[model samples]
Target: MKKKILVSACLLGHKVRYDNGNVTCNDPRFLKWSEEGRFVYICPEVAGGLPTPRPDSQIRGKRVVTGAGDDVTKEYEKGAQAALKLAKDNNVALAIMKQDSPSCGSLYVYDGTFTDTKKLGEGRAVALLRQNGIKVFGEDQLDDVEKELKKINIL
Candidate 1:
């Protein structure tokens, strides 16, 4: 059976971002992955009931909070759980996500000060998925993803 990959919907050109935009990629491998039918897309924030064009949030001392000081931890947790469920249900071992997003960033996220400060931390969903043993990759790490695919014999 082909191994499935959990990809961020925004990476697939979906307008499921907080700013109602997408971080679409046109990489050949991305298209190839889609052609191979191994892509399982999800927008955790959207799945967790957050609206499009919603307020931008960041990781603030273990809690997710909007720039305006509104708490969105529950929503982030809900989204994280939803992402995990989707990955597990589809038997996914890999995920390619957006960078620097509070919901999908696998590398680093805002430090909640909203002054463009960044910290070395994974987003809520990325952390949860990693805890579940899913190898998460940032969009810039597609080459590393290919390496991982070979490790799992999915390439």
Candidate 2:
């Protein structure tokens, strides 16, 4: 049996982003994985009850806040927990998430100013997943995904 992997819903062409848009990838491997039913999709923000076209949020001093300065740390934390539950329930070992998102970003995210200045840090969901031993990757790190899969005898 193939290993199950958690993937961002937007990366699979689902319109679950804060701006109500999807960040679909056109990679053959992604397509193949989808076809093979190895991908389990989830939108952490949406799962947390946030609506699409919602305000952009960023992490500020360990709290998640919206662009308009509304505190949404509870929602972000809820979403992260939901995502982690899904991963654990599905026995998912790998996660491919959207970069720069407050919930799913695995590498870097925008600073609280939202002026496009990125900071090196993992998002809430990514950090939680990592803490629970789930390997996480950003959308831009397909090469690293392949390497990790090979290392674990899944490639």
Candidate 3:
């Protein structure tokens, strides 16, 4: 069986972002992975029951709050948990996440200030996945992802 790879839905061209838009990865390697049926895409926020085109949220002191001041920490947590469960269930070899997002960023998340300020931190789901020993990377790291896939004999 091919090793499954967790990937953010938006990166797979799913309209799952806060604005209902996707930041699809155009890298040929991504398409190759898709064709090989190695990608298991999920939108953490959507899995947690948040709607697409929802208000933009940022991590505010352990809580995820929307720009309009609505506390959505619970939703984020639920989403993160769901993501972790999926990863474990499928034995995902690794993850390709969207960067600078509240729920999917593996390398950076927007500051709570929401002024486009970025901070070095893992997103809720990425943190949970890491805690459970799942390797996660950003969409920009497809080359690195390829290396991991090769290591796991998925290439």
Candidate 4:
């Protein structure tokens, strides 16, 4: 069986973002992985029951708040848990996610001010995946993903 790697659905060209669009990465490695049936696509925010074309959100001191000031922390946490469960069930050890997303960002995210400022932090799902020993990378970090896969003899 091929080794499984989790990926945010939007990166795989799924229209799962809050704006109902995708952050697709047409990297050859990801294409090869998809052809090998090694990609496990997930949209945690949707899994947590948030609607698409929803409000833009950011992490604020352990809370996830939208641009309109509605708290969505519970949904984010729920989505993280669901995504983690999927990874565990599939025995996935790696993830490539959308950067700067409130639910999937593996690096910097908005600073919760709706001011377009960024701060270094992992998104909720990324943090949970890391906590459970999953190696998470941003969509732009495919080189790192390839290195890790080679290190583990998965490529």
Write model 3 residue lDDT over 1-155, tens digit each, in one string.
55698999998888989999758998988998888888888999999999988999999998999999999999999999999998888879899999998999988999999899999998999999999889999998888988887787778
lDDT of 1 by residue, 31-143 (tens): 89888999999998888889998999988898888889899899889988999998999989799988898988888988889999988889989999999889999988999
Best by TM-score: 4
lDDT of 2: 0.89
Q: Give the residue spans of candidate 3 off by over 4 A.
A: none
lDDT, residue 30, candidate 3: 90
| Local error of candidate 4 at residue 153 (angstroms) | 0.4
- Model 2, position 72, has a per-residue lDDT of 93
RMSD of 1: 1.0
Backbone clash total, candidate 3: 0
**Relative to the unseen true structure, what is the C-alpha lDDT of residue 65 in candidate 2, on a scale of 0 to 100?**
92
Residue-level error in angstroms, candidate 4, position 75: 0.4
Q: Give the TM-score of candidate 2.
A: 0.96
What is the alpha-carbon lDDT for the whole of candidate 1? 0.89
The deviation in Å at residue 92 for candidate 2 is: 0.6
